[model samples]
Target: MPSSPALLRLDPTACGLPRRSLLLAPLGALAGGCTPGAPALQGGWVGTHPERGHRLRGELPRTDGPLKKAGVLIVGAGIAGLACARELARRGIDDIALLDLEDEAGGNSRAHALGGSLCPLGAHYLPLPGPEAHEVNELLHALGLAREQFGRTVWDERHLCHSPQERLFIDGPEGGYWHEGVLPPPDGAVALAQYRHFSALVAQAQRELGFAMPTQRARWTAGHAALDAQTFAAWLGAQALTDPQLRWYLDYCCRDDFGAGADTVSAWAGLHYFASRHGFHAPGDEAGEREPVLTWPEGNGWLSQRLAAPLRERIHTGRVVMRVTEGRTGVELMAWNEAAGAPERWQARAVVMATPLFIAHRLLASPPDALRAAAGHLRYAPWLTANLLLREPLLTRPGAPPAWDNVRYGATALGYVDARHQTLDPMPRPPLLTAYRALPTAARGELLSGSWQHWAQSVIGDLAATHPDLPGKVERIDLCRFGHAMSMPVPGLRGSAALAALNAARGRVVFAHADLAGYSVFEEAYTAGVAAAARLSL
Candidate 1:
């Protein structure tokens, strides 16, 4: 579908900028002509390597080279792959090789450099690990980001999100005002009651129906399965929690974490968003506190980088895994080495497919019934992240001070995070802003279609709703696209019996990706990886 001009504030008379052909359509179909103005926008896709992986869709050339051998082989170098390798190393399994399609590891957790600053390309933060996410806690403790002080786990203060943590741009009588947090404040008596009511509901969900990070650890009950059967919007409607502001914030949160809205994701996912980690907080709740998250300028890429550091010697990048065949002797893997432009064969006693379920479907010579069922039940969201290099500071709106995470009311995009927020330097020299937009399942075709310019313009237009002067201040903009970004936790996905069987599979070719958990997150990926490695009898 051709996109109409989206979120662009048109003012051709003021700046002489063209407006007609703004957001969508590329082949001159609905739109094909327009000069990008104000400041020359220079950017192309970064991080994700679709071209390399897309080769698997065609008839792959047979392997013609000498065989490479590893005691244990991992097919991805993302968090899961890396964690699996580390776990294998811990288990005294030293012969390991990780083949990745991208030139760099980190998958969606990758980062990009823009001008003098480093900004995130995908996932931006990690909330403090909960009790069940022991692997993540162990990783943090090993990284020195957290430590035991007086028998209590204390996180490094420098790594936590700085004060003025979040702000929401809301329309007001005078003009638009920035609220102190992402949640909308009570506008009236009814809204206040609704806010408190939602908070209580989240508490009830947490208390009765348990939720946990790496969600698989949570005890799934009939109540949870009932919630998992319907969309979050329907559940909210049943509760009669229909305040527009409250809905907008809830939808925003769904988009932020799950890459979709409440209407699309399951009710279980919606409540789990609040219940799993931090319970919802009303305005005046004394027990309320903003959940602290570990973040860096480069976001979770920081963690990925450290995870990849020690395993650098074992990791092979730019290798497009084409086929995986299991014979009576061992597992044979064929990969197209993108750099060499040749196909190579490798054999291992055991293989860990740390890639997504869909990719695993493509790679396996004969995918099992469980893998087929799991892939069939899952759907993925296409994500776009743009890093804007600004020449000057953005004009502030009224209300709260500038914060790290800045969001607009009823925005199509999730929001922008200031890269300079964590900086120790007090001097203000205009910082880079990383904007995130999670597109709908319908938009996956448009997102994958080559048009970084149009997508960049769309993101700029999305931000223009709040920062009108942003288009002029942007020095450079680089966009990153993830075609099958994160698995959308639609109704029935979280409760799929196939996932349970797949997760517990102890086989020669092990599946270890976020898809086993029905969605993508650091904890799930890491835990899946560690668990997969543990199941490997090699």
Candidate 2:
């Protein structure tokens, strides 16, 4: 592995600037002291519209604008909010208004067009939904991505991730790279045995209690719930699975899904990562077979666009919802319209807060004790994603062909995914590589304090380990910083009273978001939105 560039350290107090100023700082300022003639950052920064979110910290200006009335008001036009709107429309409820802070409605699932390819800025793939994931299954079927076959759900083959799905670049290996699957090369008998043993355990859990997505459908027995009390690392220790290769592979899985490692995530979540997939099969495969994942160039952003397409006029983008208050007649909401530069009040019979718990806590007026407790207990992981527009495929050692998902062992990043892998046409000359990195162990303060250029350099440096010539082949690197990317399923949090409290509807205000399910998977977000809509009907 190549060594990383020297880390750049910054002091906000010394610079006499607020932490947020770093996020908006010019790349040139971050590149200060760089060697003359060094490669300058080619692309600008893009993100989840942090400015609108930052406004939440300050009080909004009261407006004299006329009140707008609606039967239902959905806040935060992410997957959860869009799902709520879709469900409401399906029930013939068109008096619904969906509001979002960003110009786009996908939230973290947002994607950007690079050349002719669409690359994801956040979420990139969706696992095949199990039978228990009714909402997800229904959504897929509606989207024409799946079909029922012989009592099981079968995903369309074209959308399924192509073969040679994954590859790992291992350090110190004979060839330094291993092709095919996420499992490490079988160099040692003990390591191979440990890997099989762990797989057996996951298979057993799936057979007995069935790890269902959205987590709500999973059988939550006392024995299963007890896994939430300890870290996944501790569980592995108890099981005596101490192979370094196995540990690295498991850690990669945790980071890929939860943005945290085994030491940080709850054991139950770790187990769920492996066992939650059920009742999905390939087009011609029988039941219980491992189903191929469904993906597009834009990832779940494609799904989000489909969900929001029918309700474009009803969905209001660039609107920050400031507050929600309960009244005798209905729920009243105060939102700041960025374009109009004024606060607008809206009254609705019911409101679905399809946002993160932290934002919901800030927006709710006089929330109940349970809601407050739930908000306090929740924690989020920060993430950084960079879409590197390469002139050609990345330079690689002779091994397997470029897989859809590429990973490197002993690296900080989870590796890059080929955005054009799903394209029916031949791969473009300048392929887009969507790189991902999660700051699982870093403090939120640290993540917020870093400049965009700092993150870009970090990503480039990490990628240099495998593709040393990556900096030269890159056309532009679009960086995105997610301060509160996804909710962390820490020990003792998943099945706790706090999560349950957060999921429950308070009066006419129904809470929704992937965080409610303690995992930020597509199924969780979809389920939360559908459930929130159902609650409004009740």
lDDT, model 2: 0.77
lDDT of 2 by residue, 1-538 (tens): 3221111122222133333443344444323312345456577678566777899888777867668989999998989999888988988889999989888888888888876678898899897777788998898898898888998767788888887788776654333554455555544566657767777788777888668877888767876788889999999999998977678778888988898999999999889987886421212224424447888888888888899899999989988888899877789899999999888999999889888888888898877776687778777888888998876676557566788899886565789998888787763565689999888646566566666667776666566556645655666788887888898888877888877776765557888899888778888998888888777743
User: lDDT scores for all predictions?
Assistant: 0.85, 0.77
User: For candidate 1, lDDT tens digit of each residue in 411-491?
Assistant: 778889998898887787787899998998888889888588777778776676566566667677889988889998999
Residues forming the 10-long window of minimal summed lDDT in candidate 1: 1-10
Lowest lDDT sum, 10 consecutive residues, model 2, at: 5-14
Best by TM-score: 1
Q: What stretches of model 1 exceed 4 Å from their correct place?
A: 1-39
